[model samples]
Target: MFTPEVPFLRSSATPIPGRYVLVFDSAEQTESTSIGLRARAEEVPQILESEGYSLTEYFPRLGIAVVSSAAEQLDEFQARCASRRMPTRVVPEMVYHALSAVPTPQPTDSFEDTDQATWGLQAVGAVNSEYTGAGIKVAVLDTGFDLAHPDFTGRTVVSKSFVEGEDAQDGHGHGTHCIGTACGPRTLADGRGYGVASGSDIYAGKVLGSDGSGSDATILAGIDWALENECQVISMSLGADVQQVHPPYVTAGRRALELGSLIIAAAGNNAQRSQGNPGFVGAPANSPYVMAVGALDNTLSIADFSARTLPGRGGQVDTSGPGVAIYSSWPGAEKYNTISGTSMATPHVAGIAALLAEATGFRARELWAELVQEAKRLELFSVDVGSGLTQAPPPAEA
Candidate 1:
């Protein structure tokens, strides 16, 4: 009984030591009857336990498990499953990083923050949208958030940490910035607006630690929690540089959409188009079920670092967002900061997704369709910008 390791397109991604992700096919898909499905589900845990693997976490809803074991022990378990024709997939756990890149020099553009809103709000038409994401739950799974940020003073924000030994507080500023872009207050103390879904509930899940890195286990847990909470929109501004679609996210994203939650993720920032290098969309984002977002500058141009779509299924960019020189919230006394990357772009799409959800009562795939249909088609190539810049639905659409 020997099962081959899950194959991925070659890239710099390295698997975590002694950690693996196990995915079980849904009972409905693998078994012909409910009773059979139940029996197989029950037996999965017992089989893992007997195989000398430590079951670190089990997400029954997603049929995903994170396990720790010696390499040989995992091979034996995989072989047993293969011999029994168990429809299970075993992949080495890999680390993902926050998608934010170092801010490059600002482009020559007249769009800047005004008393009404930041450049991003203006670029995406969030300023004129009639709908605020009221009552909609938007989850941002990232490095955490600044609970004490003044702009979030009165907002309803529920937070939890999936990263071990860390609270939901954002030690790194990336998560705070993303949350602000997605669900910050309508008007800050200075009377400037940054967030899009100003009225949406915020669910901040700290999947990445302070060092700005997280393994697949923590990320999957965050997605599971977001799904459990029934969030309509889940924003993930993180990914690895692997060009191939990861199997775990394939299941996670598909199941999320089926459950009425749309997972929006960064398309990755590994490109350097100025140097003639157009990077490909990476894992999680490259999964077909997940909506991949590329980055756009204020001039409505694709950012130099924005990844291009790769050839084949699940490797295309689905949309673009205001990413470069984007202004948003920060932690502690910093209060505010301006940065760039597909990370900044992702929340713009998430916040807009919230608006569409509130406006059209659309969830999951429909919400995704509306967002793409409403995008302001840019002059860039489709491989880079997808349906072009994401736009907020106007009053008429609402």
Candidate 2:
């Protein structure tokens, strides 16, 4: 019931007119609220049957409800929610992008260059690892994937779309490219080898839309679905810059780790300290429980655009991976494209996580500790690369 005078995020997605989110302290409270709401449906004239607002969905597990109202009805709706002891906010639709596409690359003479087998695969030593992540379930939560991509033929892939009105198809190329790196085939039909966990089962969750963006609710829903399916590793190559970590993402990450799923996210591409302005790690990735990944170039140096961890703050970049001039799957006539950002770097860790999972039975925190311990130490500060670059486990036979 305590309404803080915090302003809506300036860059948060625009409010969908009249839509809001009501959060409760616990699932029991949410369920009780829902039941009480129904019992007093007639008394609450402002909501149930009035011109004020209407409930759309109630997710008791997450302790939230989606409601729609008119501009004039918002104040009354919030007051009523507060009176009912539920903290309410006009759900500011959060916009997330495929991190690889962030900071908007400048137009170069070779903008159309396309290649295969990114240096990231080599940088992480995935090229030499004998483990193919066989039997492990890896989830890539991003824009929907191209179901018809020839490179993924015969792979055991399960897909679901969280984007409203969109099917599980990669109209935007970001998801396809990330999936290509994390779970694509090892040897290409064209005789090129790219992906790391070529033999792992793929659970493609389309949290973003064809435009390469999605709201927080949609993303939360996707995360819930992925965890419910018990995927071992969830790769999120999408996020937005937010100094403080969002509460919902923190809760969700904790729940995921408890469920034995590791969520890895991109550190953001807003840094340009050489220009005297550097950005901090973005939310979801910034969550203490989520593993935040930064980008490195082929030479193992931090990418110019990769965000560094904020001093004594929540949004700290955890690990580094190859991100610059990276080539992976794309959509349509162009089967591949070279892109950059912490987004591209994240999947390398995800794929390697799958490999490590397959190599050992470590789950959640234990797996995370092993990954950091096995990373190659670098001369950079811990904030730039927590444990240096992630390296795959040696074959069990070794």
Candidate 3:
């Protein structure tokens, strides 16, 4: 309860004004050691209301809350907590943006969409896999999806919008592109296959809004919902460029793992290796309990904009995927588009996770281990690419 000042490194992530995230210590942390901690957790909302703070959202399962209050009230609450063992921490709510990098011109020799499959499908060996992730549930949390897009016709797409007053529809196009990569059709009308886990159930959570930005509250809500539905794999193609490990995601991820769900997130697009800038991985990908994904070009080299690993725990890239000039679905009459980023790389890994789940019957931490063990090790530094580029289980392995 005595809220300590949360130290943060130099970060490019934006903070939402006057909003703070409250993280309660888990039962195991406080129940045996401290008295009345259980009651404190249950009475947090009423206690905050009495202290002049408005509780915006309370996630009981995650032991977290979002609140709006004056600076003086927060200060007073901290003072009161300092006198008593409060077992809660407060940090400023941060805004996370979709991690799509600026589109670079596709190289003339780069792998292209063919009559059979996309270059990403080839890179991950998904095109050759026998498993189609038929019974697996994959959740993609982003800026909604283009539900009306023809590519999703006759597919089981369960969608919901966490962004208030908005429907689960792709307004920014990033989510649709991601969904296309992770769970689109096995074959398009033109006979080209772009998706990896084409037969998996689609759970699209509109965490980010049409503008491609969402606060921690919205994103956490999406995670909670996905966990509630018992999604086997959750894909998040978004992140904030903060160097510190966000505490809330640590709790959410650990609990998700305990529940047999794995959360995969973009490592962040803050680096420009071409300019000698090797950026660090950011939250929530940087959380040890979550998986952080990097981006690779068609030649199997690291992308210039993909973030590198930081010096501490939860800061390393867990794996990588095809992310440059990749072709996938889009909104409206355009129907499809090609883009790049760790954002795009994320779904490639997620789709592969689905295939692996379908192939090996693994979930949570075991699924994470399977992905790293099966990856095609690259010549790149482990700091930049971790275990290596993610690969699908071949027909023999499947």
> Which of the numbered candidates is closest to the native, going by highest lDDT?
1
Expressed as tens digits, the lDDT of each residue in 39-112 for candidate 2 is 44333334444553576655443444556666557666667767876544444445666665333333353222
Ranking of all predicted structures according to lDDT, beginning with the best and ending with the worst? 1, 3, 2
CA RMSD of each candidate after superposition: 5.5, 7.4, 5.6
lDDT of 3: 0.85
lDDT of 1 by residue, 99-134 (tens): 766555566665777887898999888988888899
Q: Residue 245: error of model 2 in Å?
A: 1.1
Winner on lDDT (2 vs 3): 3
How many angstroms is residue 161 displaced in model 2 relative to the true structure, after the best TM-score fit?
1.0
**Each candidate's lDDT (Cα)?**
0.85, 0.73, 0.85
**Candidate 2 structure, TM-score to reference:** 0.81
**Regions more than 4 Å wrong, model 1:** 1-12, 26-39, 82-85, 105-110
Highest TM-score model number: 1
